[model samples]
Target: MLFTYPIAATADNWVSTTLLELLKNAVEYLQNAQEPDGFQESVPEEYQAEFARGTKFPDLYAAFVDQCRLLNDQQRDLVLKALAGQNGFPGLFAANTPCPNITVTLQAVNQATRSLFEYAFGKLSDLKTPGSVDTVRARYHQLVHSHIASGCCPFCGLEILEAPDPDLVDPDLDHYLAISKYPFAGANLRNLTAMGTTCNRSYKGAKDILLNELNQKVDCIDPYGDQLITISLAGTVLLPGGGQGPAWVLSFDPDALSQNWRRIFKLETRLQANVLEKQYQTWLESCVKYAQKNGIDISLKEGAIEAVRKFRDTCEYETFPAIARLKTNFFELVEAELNDPQDGDRMHNFVAAVQAA
Candidate 1:
């Protein structure tokens, strides 16, 4: 939720709008059907639209309606209406918001709509013209690369963010409100953005952020919205769980949003492995070098004590956000330890660790 990329700032993507138009047409036809099974295999000439110049939108929407054939007239209409709305993403994702509680009777509709949208999603990348500069994918790449300046993923700030490279791998376009759980948002770019492979696969995969498995609901911060989080060292503990040297206590702003974000991404656990464990010793070594370069004398206990402030002063100021976040919390912990008489054990431990390196 601390992610800074603004999805709301971006205009409606033309390609997404075009795909959405097809979805609207398909859903409207089903909603207007005189009976649940009255629809034809293909649409009428006027209702047909080309997804791209040569690719037909296909005779697929009727197949989804077929899945819902056992449903009554009112149930069928409820299912179709669920598929038609896409503009609710912004409000639905905002803090304290709850998705409409569709009952189990509408389950067939949910499955059918999800299937239809995902089928459409497969063609999104091809919605562009050959070598056309004025295309949605090109614009998406430009905006993403520009806004995600550190090249770090907004989801966890733990990996590089890049546009799709033909010779290499492409980043996953993650739906903030995952399509598996929500009916209306599968193709909406407002509900979608780039995500790191680890964040997408290992952490937030197919999990319903809005309503967990226990059926509890909470509002999640929009990845593209302005509600941002900051990292800080709340405190440090010596011999955490009676085994470790030290461990970080992290916090985020706007208390309401942090809980769900933390839960979904497992921020603390991953940051510990990827950032803290990996970087702690290197940061300590850098502090020692800083002390040596600045001629901060550390020959005696008091002299070594004098170097804590200088050590804390040299935390890395890099473009990578996770590194920057680590430095902020790590150095603050070091300074706080040195300032406390009760924390002399950690203070001396830090001095020994850095100076030894």
Candidate 2:
């Protein structure tokens, strides 16, 4: 499940371009490292098959793959040897420090993977041709957009569009099984559906047990594939003393428990704290901007105004303008402190703070 805000495809130009270049470089770099032995000697055979045979650039790909795996204690020695190469940096100038090698490799792999999606979904019009022999590549492209537009939360089938950053939230059609590793005919995209960012983040790096369980659970519906419902705000109820007005509530079908639910839950909690929190904060800014651009009524407090002014005054002007244009509802809700004169007590307050004034 990957939640995303919708920026016009064009709005993502820089990110898209940089990622594509990175992927191309990675591919080219890996391709150049192929040895006479047919394998890169660095990357394992299983991994290399994901890309085309002639396109294998063992050295570069191995270095990059190793770096990402390093954090999780994955295979590293093999990756390093591939990156080190016979002369080291055969194409680029040789350097003693391996940081460049690692960095280049990571950037390449990350960009390449992203580019695969980009091209698959037609982000880079020039790279639309299918690269692999996957029979359903065309269907894959169509399904990506359909799944995204479908709005079903990938995890647990909860409706998230009504929750927040609806546009930024992206739906993912994920494999219930690890098709790459477990290629049973049933392990195809048929077991996929739309998922939210929170779900995906929580489910991140859960390949072994979760994948297996998902495969087992696959049935005819694939709720997301069928598009049974659209997530929307059902109702709002006023609270006493205007405290947190109309607590927004959402409803969705109960998510089926996977055998790895415990692990997924643990991962989700961590992702909520780390990845989703950051994404929420970032999306808040975008929502505010979108509101501002559309001429919606919004308000902000003095502190927020000051921060915006300071950010605008000191930083590069180009970036701040976008921040200045966020929606009113997008303002972060922070409580303020108020004194009860009669009781001589203090209470929290609601402060409307603009993420980007």
lDDT tens string, model 2, 1-357? 222222222222232233223333444444455322322442344333332342423343344434334332222332333323311211211122221222243454334333233233332222222343322323343344443544444343334422223254334434343323222111123333334555555563336322324444222122222323222223422122543433433222223322244355343344334433344345546444644665543353343333333333332222211122211112222111112242212112122343334
Q: What is the C-alpha lDDT of each candidate?
A: 0.63, 0.32
Candidate 2's displacement at residue 225, Å, is 4.7
- The residue ranges of model 2 lying beyond 4 angstroms of the native Cα positions read 1-135, 150-175, 179-183, 186-189, 192-267, 274-276, 279-348, 352-357
| TM of each candidate vs. truth | 0.81, 0.28
Assess candidate 2 and give its lDDT: 0.32
Cα displacement (angstroms), candidate 1, residue 152, comes to: 0.6
The number of the candidate with the highest lDDT is 1
